[model samples]
Target: MIITNITSQKDPERVNIFIDNEFAFGLFYSTKEELGLKKGLEIDEETIDKIKVRDELQSAKSKAYHYLSFRQRTQKELEDYLFKKEFSEDTIENVIQSLSQAGYIEDLDFARIYVRDKTTFKKFGPYRIKNELLQKGVSKELIDLALEEEYHEEIQELVDLVKTKYSSIIQDKSEKRFRRIGGYLQRKGHSFETIRKVLDSIDGKDD
Candidate 1:
């Protein structure tokens, strides 16, 4: 096959070579190497082709792993991320499918764990947690399932947040303390009802 064109990849170390307008090979080199020609290039055609295939597969896998390392991402999120990084559609699809089948890119499970950690550990509320899961590309059905089972835990979390924030209110003697505490919890995604109940119980102690 004739190398018709060579294009520099976004990665400075790599290049894409086309044969008769078809993608035929990819190249990796350092900046010190000569342009338009390869150095230390002693590989046979058969070896070069095999190396290209292996590199492509390895590159896709590396991208998938690096994407997952920061935090859990849904399959769709990872796909979109890889696409933005200029991976081939087929490669991105295959990588995402493989990761999902391997149980590494599960949207439902990710949503559950994410919700649990943020609500129970981080003290975030349901609305905030739900919105965060949506941002992570989790489906509404999965979000609903996680939320249904986590309501009591999240409520208890809200109670804990109230307790932690109560000291801030103790400094103010007037209604200012109650309003400030309410707004604070509201921003944290707690509803008016829960905040009111918590505040009422606190107020009863003051009476």
Candidate 2:
């Protein structure tokens, strides 16, 4: 087929190529120039396939980079994003592999950082952080490792949280008040054991 026309897309970096007077494909302007695609250039089906594959991979990588620019993403998050954009499985896999190799898709590191930030800033307990990491497609093992490394001071965190946020309930000094405090901490992802320890410490102070 002979290249019949080339038109610039609304995106200045992209262009549409027409072959035999029919819209053939859209490609990056740089790619078009690199391949020397222009009117009157003869192309074959094999060449078209090669161009499409190369362009698809490049487009997928570009989109992934843009998506990741805002924040770190889990592998599953990136995969879903690319899939939603209608990239083929092969293209998505290729992008994922490249990102992984470049250290942009480290689930373990992501989990560690997430756990640290949530625990330190959000006051989230291990259980809640674990659930969030699981939702983000982190493995249970990695979650456990991150929790172990970053969540070592859960008891102290719980103590501070209760003292700061539930002081009024503690002053009640009733069984009902303890239950209420326990419920609140549980919702914040603390375990029953940790909740009991905090309550015991408060009870001891009263004695």
Candidate 3:
């Protein structure tokens, strides 16, 4: 843990620190005066260890931020991901906290966005979308709120999907087309009553 080299760059206000022939970390300060970068200083083993810990924490935080940039992830999902990358538990927790503070890893926000996207774009029913969110480790409370708030949109979207899939066949006079379409909607995760109602609306059938 020897401070091998320290290089400063003017354009970006950054200092690159090297230890034992390995690049340890970079420090960014508003001005050269911030870090007191005077000469004749000896960095001992304890200081080097502290710097290494800080470097590792920054590295882990960068990794977590990049992963979140690609897509939203549940808390458990992120924990598993960081664990797989061999980050220490303290580092993982600190990185996760930083992301949450930056409005990145919000489970409730994720659940709401998931439901909205599923209802609007995927045209999935509440049951299917809710189950998917639950599988992603979303809590039941947010799932319930998502379903309750988006029920009408969810139902309409499912109905639209069923209609688009079976419009021509449902118009036929054959009962086979009706039953097949009903079963299709049911298998798509719509409730029985909802399927029946949507099917009947398209076919002008009683009950």
Candidate 4:
């Protein structure tokens, strides 16, 4: 096809390119320059294919940056978002590598920040935080390391949280109460063993 025209977009950073007098695509000015695209230039099918790939990569990366502008996201979250937006695998992978190398996407850093927020602010327990990070595409090793470094602090926080729940007014150690407290801890992502241990100290009741 023959290039018919190239026009500046309102954003100034992008341009609309028409081939054979028909609008084909919009590309960043940088892409336009790199591709040496200009009016009246002749492009074969193979060259058009290359341009499509470049456009896809640029579009996908731009979307990724826009998504991350709000806050950080996990690799899996980014991938899923791009996939839903209909970006191809090659484009998604390219964006991922670019963002990761740029330090915009770091699993370990994300895990640490996420864990701290959930624990300190939201009061989420180990099980819940670990599960969340896993779902967010953090490796098990990194999760273990992040939690292990603050093992004592986390356990102490868990104990304090349980105390806050079990005030002195509720003295009855009934099966129902045990179940209720256990369920609460479990829902918080605390293990049964830890729940039982805490219950033993606080309620001194049989379950």
TM-score, prediction 2: 0.90
Instruction: Please tell me which model should have the higher TM-score, number 1 or number 2.
Output: 2
**True-structure lDDT of candidate 3:** 0.71
The model with the greatest TM-score is 2
Candidate 3 positional error at 85, Å: 2.4
Name the 10 consecutive residues with the lowest summed lDDT in model 3. Answer: 29-38
Predicted candidate 2 versus true structure: per-residue lDDT over 1-207, tens digit per residue: 999999999999899999999999999988888888899999999999999988998899989999999999999999999999999999999999999999999999999999989878887789999999999899999999989888865565677778888777777877887788888888878888878888777667422
Rank order by TM-score, top first?
2, 4, 3, 1
Q: Between prediction 1 and prediction 4, which has the larger TM-score?
A: 4
Residue range 1-207, candidate 4, lDDT tens digits: 899999999998899989999998888898989989999999888988898899889889888999999998989999999999999998999999999999999888888888787777766778898998898888999999887764333554665676777665246678776787788878978788887777766655534
> How far out, in Å, is residue 94 in model 2?
0.6
Clashing pairs in 3: none
Q: Residues 1-207, candidate 1: write the lDDT tens digits.
A: 455666788987677766656776676643213333443234357755656555665677787898799988887788888888888787787788888888888887787788778776776667878887888788889998987876454444565666776776654658787788878777767788777776666656322
| Candidate order, lDDT descending | 2, 4, 3, 1
Local distance difference test scores for all models: 0.71, 0.89, 0.71, 0.82
- Backbone clash pairs in model 1 (N, Cα, C under 3 Å; residues 3+ apart or in different chains), count: 0
Comparison by TM-score, 3 against 4, better one? 4
TM-score for all predictions?
A: 0.67, 0.90, 0.74, 0.84
